[model samples]
Target: MAEQLRLVVPLHGEQVSNMQQLVSVMLVDDEIMALNNLKNLIDWEEAGYTIVASETNPRNALESFHKYRPQIVLVDIMMPVMNGLELSREIFALNIPVRILILTSYKDFLYAKEAVEIGISNYLVKHEINEESLILELGKLKYEIQNTETNDRYLRQRLIRHLIGGLLPPENLEIGIKNKYLDFKIGSLAFLFAKIDTSYPILKEISVVAKSHSNFIWDIFNLANDTEYMDAIRLNPDEAVFVIYFKEEELKETVREIASKTCKKMQERFQQDYEHTISIVPIIVDNKNQNIRNIYSIAENSFNYSVYMGKNIIIDYESIPTAVNSSFKEVSVILNELESDFVKRDSESLKNRLNIIFTLLGKPPWNPEDVQNTCDRLVFTLVKFRNKNSIQDNPSKIEISNLFNLNSIRKWFESEFISSVENAVTIDALRYSRIVRKILVILHHEYNVDLSIEEIADRIHLSAVYIRKRFKNEIGITILGYLTKIRMEKAIELLSTGEYKVFEVAELVGYSSSQYFSKVFKKYSGLRPLDYTSGV
Candidate 1:
């Protein structure tokens, strides 16, 4: 009979909490029956732990340990091929922080001592042990796992906050690196900023195809230590930034393959199950001799390029143009354009000109800092405009420089621009006011002639799509329909005066033929033109 049997003893009819706060355990022994008996050795849930894996073969036990990363292991010392000591050493070599206890015979005291030397947490005498002692040791192991995980999480939380707040010096960041608590050294960390808009349910489906959001995040955190490091933390509902630490020389070979492959696999899975977009922008901080604060600043400026880059992509910061601020004559021109476009509610022109100007600033030979400063300079103009203009959309002064990605920057600008224009622009100049009023004015004066919605859009320096959306949103009807209603009302007024013939009245109210005009008038007015002319 084979000694190695891979299994997890099923606890039938037992329901576990979805967010169970339980430490997981694995057991290994030569006897299958002994493995089964060990399952009942501790009240797993009560001790805040559960038996996740049980295998008779030491080889199978090692495999399961790596796969599940169980927090605790209980193994028998006397086994063929790989004894308990060899197995414990192999487990500890992974450096994943698991507690391993050996089950040995009293006659095997020498072997037990050797096992202890190999870093086994403790050894249990097979003949002497009872549930009480087993439970006591298990409780201690559970405490150790709890304390370690808690401390690691606390350290990580503090580090992340400090980095985000830009509060820590490079020396402070090096503390975690020196202690091997973080996956990478302080000087070699890179940031991968991503914008993900997904529901938990959708993520669950995607998770089945690819790594879960949590696992992918943690993988990068420990990429400096090993490729297999897995962890995840959600920053908020929309955005998350993952860190990958790497040496500058490793960027071409080892790091690029790992980073690109991870991103591509996740992106392919998302494309398979979901239709929405995802954004990933990777920026190497070049921290070997740079300050931590400078890394954060530069990385942020570089990531802003991703706004132009679509979702489900892996973008390298080095490949994109770094923005530099120059006091070129073009800066003032762009600002002047933004001031007029924002007030005129001319989104199409505004966006086009912005894309051109932003590209100009982002071209080669530009420092990323100066480019961001240029953008900051432009935003300041918008802020000044907002203060004087009607509240078309006063998106509060978000430190645009503080925004990390291109998509974020463009989204913020588009959403808050027309509405947040300066008070001095006055309400009448805004899109809401201008688009609606302009359309009405055009139709009122031109109702007696041929006028198309496209023509109205052209006259206002806006697209038909923009006009239609704003028209329907504000006036509650399609442009053509509104034009028809105005034409009909004018026709009725002309007929009531009883001065012009029906054909003449039709031409006067924008009808090419009096016949089509009469047909439309009767349908809308519930009577022929003559009946209406009779004043009935």
Candidate 2:
């Protein structure tokens, strides 16, 4: 059985009845007497309906409808300012799931056909709206409304598909609006594009985790005071976009942080649930392309920065200098160096070579699609090579497919090459080098943890003295010195972000004492943390 969603809000008169759940209803008519009669005409609570709003003025109908968002609306066909059809049109514009009934006299009932044309589904002549007929229609409409809610999931998916494919013109929003599929609106808008990676297919998980993830995203941003409405549109597999309707002032100041935090929370939750992180590249996109191709094009280009900035990270398109996509020939050089570094157990050399490749791709005057396709090809080749060698750690197809950015390729290469070098390291003591390599991996993953050579030696069944000597011989640095270098590098990187204070950065780099971290940082970088920030 499909699970049902129960949404409850306190009604104005909660104690009026013993019913815990009731379908909300609304009545709209030009005559005050008619409105009152409709409200009292049926034993609504007995029929599982509650008249939340009754308005004699059509001008006030829309306001009441919006505020209550009632499931059923009974509106008169002819009225001043706005007739039932006009009011219904606006009410339907919100794309809310509502069953609208047209209330008309015999003369006005001629246009009842028109009400159906305007998306009204039920109609009843004024004299005929008694308890029996009202009961029958409400019961029938209630069933249809519940069925519509049942199918709402697919509708939302269709809405997202339309948004990602590019929304039609405002005039064309009618068909979608008439079906009550989505609230079509235009205003101060900012967009965020997300790149997701998961082993499970999105379709299989659409009902639960996917919806929960989407809900979590909105919950994160809606907490902000300056935003009125926030929504997300899932793009093609592994891609999604968040749309924020912000106050004009917030457009410049808050959008970037909201986008960043959303990216962070999403990656963290997936890592928690799936045991794998979905690296996201989020950027504020240009709304100027609402009708043109550039709307998604600019966002796609910015997301491609995952190539340079790395995974499980956020890069704002506006903050970074634009990069150019590389040509096929230029990318081929990167491939050559990759092979050489793999053969030589040269991780550092590979890092530099990959850095150069990404830097070239990060520059301007390049096609975003071409570069993304190139990265995809590169990741595919690397994964195929890893599988061919029977390496234990091959990236899942989902991960490889999500490698549509530069930083993604860089991270994958560093990791795979580390394993490659480990499998075939040509040092005099093979087991010793492997032990040292294991230590390096720990340092990389747990840079935030307070760690020492003794602790690591115990973790991997080696003596502290042996680990120290072998690490120095194989990697050319004392364990302490290496740890200090890694910590200092992290400190500098965090300080450069300008987001954290010296003490916070110190803690983040595994230093309990800001003073000691600063002392070590100064020795390594030739400057204090604050001083380094000024230069950056």
Candidate 3:
């Protein structure tokens, strides 16, 4: 027979002698049996630092520490009442340099180090320590605690500074395209524009998909550090714009494949989760050195073409017919109406005319492909008109210039005419009014000093007379009146802050004298500055 075997049971109970009052001992732990064993193992008097009381509850440790002001504390790493680290932090807050010895399992060394960093003096490995080792470590820590000072008062201030330093604001497309740290070289370059069929909520789903599948798209496109791709999707509630960068010419097929796959995956993944369809426009980047804005235009035009041609189809600009047979007479009539409506600020009428033009171009039942073809013709025709006007403005009698070349016309249209159209439309009457609002803000913020009207005009890229007229028409006030309003508003804010006297506030916000500023403020707000702040 095998020798009679005795299995060792973990020590789970504390033993204390009746001579406990001579040196009080405090043990904090979540495991009742373990806490009891620790109490039994340590001889309080031999260690020099006496634990005043023993507690299993961590929340009670703070009150006990404050009450006893104990010279030593033993805390467990894993506790139910409160974690040892949290309890140590609270104890440190009391401005007491008590020797905190951590009672943790041998497996808790990582946590023990962290505990020590938070002001714990010694980390005692439980189930391995006996009376001799506990007293030896505690005797050593007692000397350190006697000379230590608690600097825990500045903890929150340091934490807040670190948190603030970690925060960063988001960057938009301008920054993304210009970021030098980001690598943008890929094997081949291609652009995909994804348009969502529903409103903003619906459009947000595709944006989520785009971000999720970004790595898949990059891998499928075979992008590398020296050869990478960049993509951006400007999302509206109803529509979205997507632009991609890859190796020119070579990656066209992969781009189309990835784009189509992405759109398909997005549609299927989101259809059950959301109601939306994502359509894609695939365009090849022919010139990497060309302006990014030009690449943007190509992608944008291709996307618009996608909407016109059909939904969810990849259309290449090079494959499309350069010349389409259409009646320019009808197109010219439509353009005249559009030009007049734009000048008159009749957006409703312009939208109606545009709809009619699209309809006429589509013929019956409205094939979008035909409409796209017709719009291309319209753009070409308008570009030709602009070049003819330019030639007339700068007449050259040189016979060599008369030579006909289609390629030259195409380049001129892309490089010059398209940009001109963008600049013209972007600052039209609608956008002009927004610019005036921004100008008003600038004026109010800087009214006390001399601001050059020419400089302001140059900033907005409009003539002085044009600025004055447009500002007046849109705002129902001259630049001076608007500036005065802003200055007066600032004066009221300053008076309310109570940091300055009424007279000082007036001068600070740009008025030379308090009396004049008060009179103007009264006229605008139905009360003088002093009376207003005084509740009169």
Candidate 4:
């Protein structure tokens, strides 16, 4: 014999009545008088129906749907705003397993059959319902639905717990988990959090691409390449977390490689404009362990560690050693060398110093923070140099105030680093170098023209003196000297090709006087421009 399910009664009592425990129901009718009459005449609470919400206004049905999300909807066939049948159809589209009971007074069997086709649970004629009959009908519906108060209550509590768990403050995470009204079993898991350092515009592009398909969850999981238990969830608008379950014996280095590759792929695929950090916490917890109060704290600390150590790093809780001092020492050494080069105004030495730092770090060629800091310091130094020295005292000179504001170096560094971090290993250093390279290219390209150093600086959004110093530090030549060399070279090329007269060539290279152009060209090349070009 099969086990019979227990039922509860509906009555004015503290405990649920016998018939009430078996089912939950909702009631809806367009006629206010009729709806209230039914509510007063029938003891619905006794019939195992939980009237979550009763609305005389059908317009509020959608709001009720969001609020209650009930298992059953008793609706009138005709109503205003949202008609009963139309509302029923729309509600069914939500894919909720709702048992809808339709009430109608007209003798329309055809309409009743249509309701059945539309998945209505039952059709009742309004005139046929009396106080006793209603009780009997509701009791039958209760038994049919087989609602369980205990199970329903537990599920609701679990959903609430899940949502609250993710949103809790860092300090309150574990406390929130512990105070959950529902019971859940947790297992040992590995957690990682990440922040994509991108501008709002770039982030929006990523967002659009991320939602282009339903396979995002699966795609990210596959990207992790973890065959073991894997779960991923978006923690916030700009961050995500991946939870992985693996035995301690698993190769941990492989996890770091996977994470780095994933970050690279995201950058390449989305053309991301900034560096991002993937913080890792590889931990082991039993299935029954539910404490997560300090989860965010641990994760946040790990995140800051990653940022401090530089981005794109994977730090495992299981692998940290006692020799943290050695790591700090190496970083300090690099910083000291960079600071020394900046103070000395040694352009070639600074470049060589940065190269050494990159080699020591064993990161990619594109990585090194030295060059970035050097660019910043060089810019500032030039601005100070110009403020103290008058350029008119030496016409063959450049002025810092004419070009860029050295004080805005921080903002400039941020924009450059955040815009092309993907192609860089040492993101900060690469950004500074790249910007310096761009300025040099522009200067060289327009060397023979009547170019204003300040204009070029303004074009690239840097100060003239700062640009000159930074260019000298990176390219091993002062900006004016380089430009002079380029114009002299062009003058020689024109003379050699016999493209124009000596006077014309002189004017072409930005000198109004041919004698002056010849004097400058000979001084730079150790020969007269015409003689160097003639070679006879």
Q: Which model scores highest in lDDT?
A: 2
User: Lowest-scoring 10 consecutive residues by lDDT in candidate 1?
Assistant: 1-10
Candidates in descending lDDT order: 2, 1, 3, 4
Query: How accurate locally is residue 323 in candidate 1, as Cα lDDT from 0 to 100?
Result: 46
What TM-score does each of the candidates earn?
Answer: 0.44, 0.42, 0.24, 0.28
Error of 4 at 148 (Å): 13
lDDT of 4 by residue, 110-226 (tens): 888888888887777888878777676666655555453334333433443354366433343445444432233222344555454322111122332222223333344334322
- Model 2 scores worst on lDDT over the 10 consecutive residues at 1-10
**Tens-place lDDT digits, model 3, residues 1-536:** 01111111111122223332122346788778887787667656655545567777888877777665566788887887578888989989765446687877776667867876887877877877988888778767655543331222122223222322342222432353233212333334445555543211111223333333333322322211111123333333333333334332244556566555544544454433333344555555555454444554554555543433543354565554333455444645665555434323344655566666655654422333444344465454444444533322222232222112222222332333334443344444344567785576467446766566777888888898988888899878988787777677556655654556888877766777778888888899999888878868
The TM-score of predicted model 1 comes to 0.44
Report lDDT per candidate: 0.61, 0.63, 0.52, 0.52
Model 1 lDDT at residue 40 = 72
Q: Residue-wise lDDT of candidate 1 within 1-536, one digit each (tens)? A: 01111111112123434224577789899998787777876666776777888999999889888777688899998899998888888999876678888887666667767877878898888877778888888888878876766666546655654656566534655574435633344234445565553321211222322224444433333332222122223454444565554432344454555556555554554455444445666555553544544555554565455444534667666777544545445654565556445545566777776776666654565554444555565566565556544345443455333344444455456555644533433554554576677886676556667887788889999998999998899878988888788778667756765667899888767888888999999988899998899878
